[model samples]
Structures are given as structure tokens and as C-alpha cells.
Target: MQTIPDELTNIIASKSQKLAYQLRVAWDLNDFLATITFAVVGTSVVSGQDIVKGNAAAVTEWDKYTYENETQYVKKYEFIRETGFPLNSVIKSRASIVLDNTSKRFLPHALPFGTAVEIDDCDVATGWTQSQDGIAPTISTSRKEGTNSLNCGINTAASENTYAQYDKAPSVIDISSIADADKKIALFLYVKDKTKLATANAVEIRIGSDATTNYYRIQIVNSEILQNGWNEIKKAATKVGTPVQTAIDTIRVIFNEATVPASVTLGDLKIDYIRICDSTEEDNYIGSFIRGGRFIKLFSGYNAYSIPQFVGMTDRPKNNIKLAETIINAYDVLHYLETWQMSTGYLLEDHRGDEVIAQVLADAGFTAGQSSLETSMMTIPFTWIKKGQKALDIIRKVCEAENATFYVDEEGIMCFENRYHLSQSPHTSSQYTLDYDEEIIDVGLEPTEVINKAKITAMPREVQASQKIFEKEGASVINAGETLELWAEFQDDYGELPCTAITEPTAGGATSYFKGNTSENGTETDKTNDLSIITWETLGGTVAKMIFTNSGASKVYLTELVIFGTPAKVVKEISYETPDTDAQESIDEFGLKFYELKNDLIQSADYARTLGDTIVYSFKEPKKSLETTIKGLPHLQLEDMVTVNEGSTGETYYMYVAKIEKLAEGYFYKVLLREKVIQSYAIVG
Candidate 1:
């Protein structure tokens, strides 16, 4: 050790400094600090002298002091020496030293703390040999006054005192080859000028090669001392005062193939000291160094960033101060909250079933305060898309229709990206238009809305219960408008989707037109008591005009109808009403049902009472079934049930049940009818 001073600077615990700030307050936080000699050299190395020494290192925070990024950069100097009067005699020539992040000219990871050991600055010394452990040669020549010291800036170009010496800072000591060796090496560094930004400039003591290549480094403390006219970097480290920076670690290079390189420079240079000791003497680390880590909370789980190795820390919670602050980063607290929200959504979807789409729409921010268009394909019973204006209401119909987003093409046509699109029949003219000034369908990553011509030649469809028609006295409809509506209700070919509904009468029916006396146009009733529905009304006298209606070209096929014997009867019906259709494999708002009527010749006056709800009924049809199925209807209501098995008895009888307690006569309801009756009651359950 060098000559002992009158006072000893404490590296771990102290008595003098604490007494100086006796009145100062200490918060309720743990007083945590790393002991350099203790961690790096263990108990043996410090058995006599301090292998490394320092007071306090506090310049690692943001906004206080910063170092250059590139290991090298440029700077202009000031000329401050007297001119011409032999000023060259006293003025010194000093080499410029660049601060580089990927540099190692100083102590490998840091500078020797107590008193620094350096090699001779002459280029001719020993031809520049580096120890296998990376320590540069020791300096033997006497210190000489540097010559290139001058200041040249502004109006005054006089010779001014310089701060940092470019040729003489801390040199990095590289000993990476012994990383896994059974020896512990302690690195010492000299730091200075740790203060405010304008007053301090942090110098980096890089311990590695090019950023892309390898190693470690630290912010050289006391870099500001250079600006303050300090020449000897090693001399500054020996001062008994507050230290600016420090380091000790075992962490190796990250070696990321895809990480951005931080600024720092390095080049052909020399090394000086390498103090390697047996592993039994100490741990391969440097403690007094400010190399540290932090804890991070994550979404999938929680983890900790362990400290780097060279700084002497290898385990998590590397430091007490860091460990205490992150104690509350619990995982279940966040996981359960997220899970609860997702589960809630699932329950709502199941309870509301198909209506859940509307429920979701209700929460959408944009849908508020705006009226939606009615979709012909939708059973939405709203007034926005009333019949007789379907063409004019086409755009609005789509908006009001559920499961649709609005769209506008350049040609100025407002439309929807709905599959049930009331206007199922695509526009024959390619000149389809939309509002160009507004937002349109770019959903699902489609850059532009591609209007594809999809000719739906076939589909897996469904049919609804048969619709009954009553006779009214009026004119013979030119379009047989009432006939089209009636034929659909009495037949099976009208598919489920409104666009799939049958609008024309088939020629094969026993009586294609339910021809009867036309009724006087008087009153009407709104469609009520149903699951989902679309509404329509007759236009002129029996004309059944459906002009410009937004409910696009849709058809309705009544597969089965239920008539109550106690309700009102009907003949050939003349009123108009929107038809119910089939299952939407792709966002369809329609429904379909099927019934096996009792008669080959069904009647219109069979219904006696209007049921409260449509009974549940279903059937399966081939996916490719098209328009040809709407040919005829079964004309029966009450049929024989007793002793009726599958056979052509060729006998006709009205089927009914009555009882007299005198002597009850019982009969077998057809095995099929028995099953049907059981299902009819099952619906209410």
C-alpha cells in the first residue's frame, strides 16, 4: 500500500461522515449498499489493505450526468497560450482522448480504487505486451508535463489550463478468458467529477470490443474533473472524498443478434494492470461498482432481471433496495380480474342467444343516436324499413338490419357488408354507387371493398310454417300478387331467407291462384306476438304494389301451418305481410319451420284460434335445394288418428276426441301422431 494517510476513508460503514450530517433525516427504507472489497476479494484479500477503495458512487441516475454513445466522437479545442513569445516552451502538448462505450483502455470493468497503477506512456516500452489476463504494462518513467495544453475560442486565444488528458484516463483490463477459471479477480477504477450536467461529464470505461462483438463496461466517474483542470486520472482516484462511479460483476455479454448498438468507440490500444487471485481469496466480482438490475412485471407471468456478473451479483433480488420496492407485483391480482371480465361476456352471449348480436351492438360507441335501416332479410320489425319503399330504403334497410356494417362506394351508393343483405339480388349494372366521402368496409384487413358477383345457385335452406290466406272481393291482380304470397305460404319450395322467399306462383298447383271473391280494403293490423318478423301492407286496390321497397328481392315458402279449431277461420287471404324464412349459416336473421299437415287438400278456413306463440317445429332439406319445391299444399286439418297405421285405407274421416264417463271407448292415436303430440307439449317446457 502507498504511504498511510492520517484518516482512513470507509468503503462500507463509517463514523466520521455520519457525525458530520448528524441532524439529517433517514427515511424508513433499508440502508442497502455493496461492499467492494468484501464481495470482490472476499475476507482474505482485505485481510490487510483494501484491494479497491471508494466513498460514495451516485452518478448512475438519469438527467444527472451522461456519457457519449459511440465509443468515439469529435470536438473542437480552444487556444489559450500566449502568442509567439516562445509560448511553446511552457505549453504542453496533450493527446485527445475520446469517450467510447465499446472501449477497454482502462481497468477492464473499472479503475483501481485506492492508488492507480499505470504503464509508461512511451511507444517504445517493451514493444507493448499484454498479459494473458489483459493487464497492460506498468509505467516506469517519471511523469512529464504534457505539451499540447492550450485554449482557443472567442476573442481570447490565450493559453488556458486544460481539464482531461485524452491520452491518460482509466485503461480497461480484459481478463475474459479466465471467466470460468477457479480464480477471483478484483478490478479497481479511479472516478472523479460526479455532479450536475453543466458541471459534470461522465466518461465511459468500456470493458468490451465492438458492440456487435463482445464484453462489458461502466460510466467512468469524475470525467468532469478533466473539464475542471485535472491531469492525472489515477491521482484523482486516491483522493479521500465522494466517489462518482464504481463497478463489480460476473454477468457476461448478452450477445443479442438483434439489438441496437449503443454509442462507444475502441481501437488499437494498450492495457496496464491485471490483479488476479485464487478463487479461495475472493469471488470473481467487483462490488463497489454500481452495476445493478430491476424487477419487471409482465402479462403472462412475473420474472426478475438478475444483476450482471462482473459487478459481483449473480442471484435475483441482487440488492436489498431493489427487492423491497417490487414486493407487491402479485400475479393472481391481475389474472383473476381479466378472467372475470371474459367470463361475464360469455354468459351474456349464451343467455341472449341470437339476440346477443344486438346486445353487443347496443354497446358500440358509434351506433348511438342514429336510426338503422331495415334489412329485408332481417326479421327486424322496425318502422325504418317499411314495405312499398324497399328500393328507396335499400341502404337504410341494411343499416337497420342486424349484423351489418355500413359502406359507401365511390359511385355514391350507401350499402352494407351484410350477407343477409335485404337486397340479395345484386345490381346487374356494374355502376353500383356509394358515398365516397365517408368510412366504408375495410374490415378483416381488406384494403378495399371488393364487390364480388356471387351467383347463389344453391344453398342449404329452411322452410317456415304454412301461411293461411282468406278471400276478399276485389280486382284480378295483374301480377297475381296475392297469388304469389298465398302459393308461398301453402308450398315448401320458398327457402328461409327473405331473398330466398318465393314471390311468383308455380304452375303445377291444383289451383295455382287461390281465386275467390276479393274483399273491400278497410283496416289492417301490425304483425304481433312472434319471435322475429318483417312487416308489409297492400298498396292500391288489390294491386299489392311493392315499389322501391328497401326489402330487397326476397321470397317466403310456408312449409307447414298450425290451425286452432277454436279460432277464427279464413278463405283466400288478400292482405300483405313480410314472410319468415330460414337459418342464417352466415349472419342470417331469418328462421324456418316444417309441419306434416293432415290433409292432401288443405283449406283456408281451418284456423279457429290465433296461437300465443309459434310452436317449435323443424325439418331437414338438402343444401342444394332451389326454387322448384314450391308446387302444392296439403288441404287437411282434422284427420283420423285412431287405429291409423302406415297404409292406404282409402277411407276419409274427421279426427276428434270426446269422452263420456258412462263407458269410455279408447283408441290408439297414430304412433307418429303420438310422438308429434308429445313434442307439441315439449315446446312450452
Candidate 2:
């Protein structure tokens, strides 16, 4: 077995080298690594010697690590000369070397256009190769389109293996694209016998590597068909289970007539357009590649990133020694948390039926009752594809809406507690209290400048539902100015027998000129009123109107009061106000800003006001960075609230653990702090 290098094993674990820092800080840096050996949770662990011999495999997690002394953790690391580490902070690491949910390729069910081999219009013998038999195949034009069908003459000599074949060469179609052997494909072709035969063995189709190699044949018994008309035939074939090295090279149509007793000369036959289709309805190429998986290799790498930050947190925490703040890598924090860094997400339907946010977090294996989510159905027709999307995004939305924060505590369980809940909780009962009792090395708060106003603009929700209904209005009558006229309107087609005009009196019936429906060519169906001018003076009538009564199955409504006129346009605007008055004044002071949004996923006013209050509260609790050599709280998590008592005045200040930096070769941890507040009621501005 290969042995580990003496220099690497003897090297001290310190920040003196970049590699050492990674091994100690970002311990779970395998996904971005290459050509290295290690072990992860749920699998076996190997030593540096195993890796050198090329016998080591990849794993998923580095579950636990213990400090060798007060300043060092003697964890084993295997390295190779060709190993590479692309130090990307957000790189994803996998523990095992097995395919999980990644898909690389997909083949569609229906083959694309020109995927099939059509008959050559210029040359009938372009793709086909004649058998070695004495009788050669030729083109038959009895009934032809484009190119005549292929005709293989009878095997006069009664040759056992004589057949006509088509070879798919690499030049014609890129065989590499469809070379997958696991794919099940079907061949379709039209075949007919030129002359009827009394006895024949079978017409068989073969597909595989070559005429003699691994292949399958589908045989059509001669007794199963009549001889004259063209019969469409289809046969299915599957390649071997093991992946093939090359593409399919041959397709053969063997005329197996020699098996018949006293075999007569084979009758002339024709084969038309040959096409290949996926045998299964699904995308065979995608299914084969995805379902048929292989191994995934993971190695060691560095430059790690954290699981996204909490809401209202700064991009970079303020560095102050009093609050325990130090220049620490975010991924180092993730390494300490380990198993507590779990992921969960929910694409809820109607939120009424689904469990509350607390239950969701609990079901996802986090601590129950520590946090809560809003219960109202936020979005209509909510659909989450859920493919590779982080559950943290969902949690972020809830936290932004409900003013909450999530973190894994010292107990190593995910907790979702609102900012208010932590603000009101007793300081003495906190997970960590820094007073005269424990690691209170130094604590100080820094003042931050305040802004007068804050504005949040979001895409407005479409208040109108997706669908609308067209309303019908009552009908109205019209009289040609100062002229005797009869006017009627049918908003929608009733498909009823034509009604006769029953005028108030016989004298009022002024020629009963009617123009109701339009024809296909857009002309009035009955233009009786088109050329006639039946005025009051001409027909001697005070009022001219018609009433209709229909006795038919079809029912319709009157569409308009005045039929021949265009309607006016309608414009609408809706406003959503916040409970905070001072915040609204600031929002309007900047001018009327418009946010044309298409979703109600997040309401803007409350979100903006809450942010404003958080800022105000933040001014009260100054930023502090404490320097401590606290061994017991080595596993402190981000967003964990701890009460800090002043070493001098004994004044209490509750702060959140924003950042942690391990220094002096891991002897001390510098933790950054942020103020926490619980606004029980809505902030006015």
C-alpha cells in the first residue's frame, strides 16, 4: 500500500498555511475538492495511505471533531500533488459517491424531423446493401412516390441466410447521439409481397451491433398475413443491459424461406420508408440516463460559504473585540454546526388545511413551538417546482413577513423564534449569559447613525382574479329621427324562428322594416330597412316598435340598450394603506412611487414599517464584539441571542451572535453581536 508523506503528517495544524486553515475551519470542504481522500457520515472512513493507493472512496459528512489540546485539533488530512481546490464559498458538498437527483440528458418520445430514413428520391439503393445471394435487390415502380420501393428477388438457390439489409453509417446520422443501448426502440416499415406464396417461413427484422453480433430479431410468421396489399409492420427491440461502446451499425430484413419444405423460389417483395420510434411512451433517453445512474466523486477543497444570513443582518458584521468579533470565515461556523444545518421547504396549497409554520418546522425535524409562521393563505394557486430550490428561501420570506429569525443552538437543533419572542424572554434563562459567572472577557456596544425614512416598494398583487364574466344589459328601442321606424336588438344568438312585428295598432305598422343579424360577409342578414325611408309622415305612426316571443330550446339575453354604439373605456386603481401613519408620510414625501406587481406573496407596508422599527431598536442596542476563550460555547450558532451583563456597571444588554472567528490557533473565539428587540405591537412610523 502507498504511504502518507512524512512532511504532511508532521505538519502542525495552524493558520500559517492556507491549506491548514481550510482543513481546520472549513472541515466539510469536499465537493469543491478533487483528487483527495476522506470519509463522510453514513459511510466508511479511510486514511491517507488508502487515498495514495487509489483505494479510497468519497463520503458525505465530517460528523465530529475534538480538540487535541487547548489550541489544536489533530484531524487527519490526505493530500495528493494533482489535487485541486476551487475555493468558491457557496460550493455544495456531497458525502457519498452515488448519483442522487441529478439528470444530465433526456431523449424525447417522438423522434425529431429527419430522424427517420426516408427513401432517396434520386437513388433508390442509397442506404440498402444487397445480400451475397445470387439474386440482387432492385427498385420496383409499380406504385411509387419519391423513390420506388426496394424489391428483393426470391432466393432462387434457397439460400438460408440471404437477406436485404440497411446500415446506419456514422456519416448519414450522428450515431453517437443515439448510441445508447439501454434505450428501447421500435422499427416501423411498410412491406408487401409482389407475388403470393403458398408456403414461406417468416419475414424477420434484426437490429444490433452487426449482422453477427449482439442483436434481437422480431419474426412475422408468413401465415399471419395475406400477400397482395402493403401492410404496415412494427417490431420492438432492446439493447443489452450493459452500456455499449459504439452505435447501432445494422438493420436486416431476412427472408427466411429456406425453412419451408421443398422451398419454392422466394416471391418478389417491397419495403417502404423505415422509421424508428421510442418503444415506450416516455422520454427513453432521459429515463435511461437518469434512472440508470453511476458514481459521483467528492474530494477536499476550501473557501467556504455560510447557509444564507438572517433577515435584518448586515452583509458583514462589525468587527469589535469587546463583542467577541474577529475575522472568521462564514463556512467555519457551518462546520461547527454540522448536522444542525438541515434543509426543509414547503410549497403549500391553501394554508388553512396545512399545518402552521411551527408544525412545518417541527415536521422538518426542527424544534417545535420555538417559532411560528403566518396562518393566512398568502398566495393563490401557489405552486413550487421544488427542484433544487432552497427551503431557506421560504423561511426567509416567513421571517421577513413575521419578523422572525432561525438558527441552530448549542443543543444542535434548528429553532425558529420570532425577534419579539427573544426580546421578551428572561435574560437569566438564556442559553448563554455573560455576567460575573462565565466568559465575560469584555463587552462594549457601538452606536450607529439613524436614517429619517425607509421605503419598501414591492410588486403589487393583481386584485382582480384571473377570469371575468361578460354582463348583459336590458334592450332599448329606437326611431329613425322624425320617421316611422321599428328597432329591435338580440345581444346573443337565440337561434329561434323569426318573429312577426305586432305593432300597437295596424296604423303603427310602418312596413315593419327590420335589420337584426349580420351575415358571414358582414352584411345585414335582412336589410328591409336599408333602402326604405318609412318616416312618421310616410307611414303615419306616433311610435314604431316591435316585440318578440320565442318558443325554442335556445335561451339568449339582450346585449345592449342602444345596439349600434361603442362603449366607454373603464380605468381602475386600488390603494393599500399601512397601519403606521408616520411611515406613510415618508413614503409619499418622496413623490407618488408606483410598484406594478403581479403577486401578493409579500405585503409591502407592514414589511417596510417593521424594518423601520428594527432600525430604531438597533440604535438602542449598540454593536459589540466580545473576545473570549469560551470552550463550552465552541458550537455557538449564528442569530443565537445571549444576554451580556456589563463587567463594570452590571447593566444588561441582549445581543445576537452575528459572527465568530477562531484565533490564536483555535484557542479563542471572537463573536460579533447585534441588538435584538421585540415590538409587541405595530410600529407607528
Q: Which candidate wins on lDDT?
A: 2
Error of 1 at 19 (Å): 79
lDDT by residue (tens digit), candidate 1, 502-602? 23222123321221112212123211111111332332111122211112122222222221111111213322111232223311322232222121011
Instruction: Report the number of clashing residue pairs per model.
Output: 118, 21
What is the Cα-based lDDT of residue 388 in candidate 2? Answer: 32
TM-score of each: 0.15, 0.31
lDDT by residue (tens digit), candidate 2, 1-685: 0122344323312222232222222211221232232432111225411111111122112222210110122222211111001100111111111111111112211232223332122126555665534245556542122225566545545444444333333223223333343333333223344232323535666555555555545566665544344454544544433323244555666655433222223224555444443333232122211111112111221123111111110011112334332221122112222322223333343342123344334433333333333233233223221323444444444444444544433222344454444435442234566663456444444542322233333432222221111222443222222222334332223221111112221222333222322232224343223222233221111112334332222222221222121111111222243233444553454443222212233445555545555543333223444534332233344446677777667778776655554433333445656554435643333
What stretches of model 1 exceed 4 Å from their correct place? 1-620, 625-685
Which model scores highest in TM-score? 2
Report the lDDT of model 1 for residue 487. Answer: 13
Candidates' C-alpha lDDT: 0.20, 0.34
Query: What would you estimate as the lDDT of candidate 1?
Result: 0.20
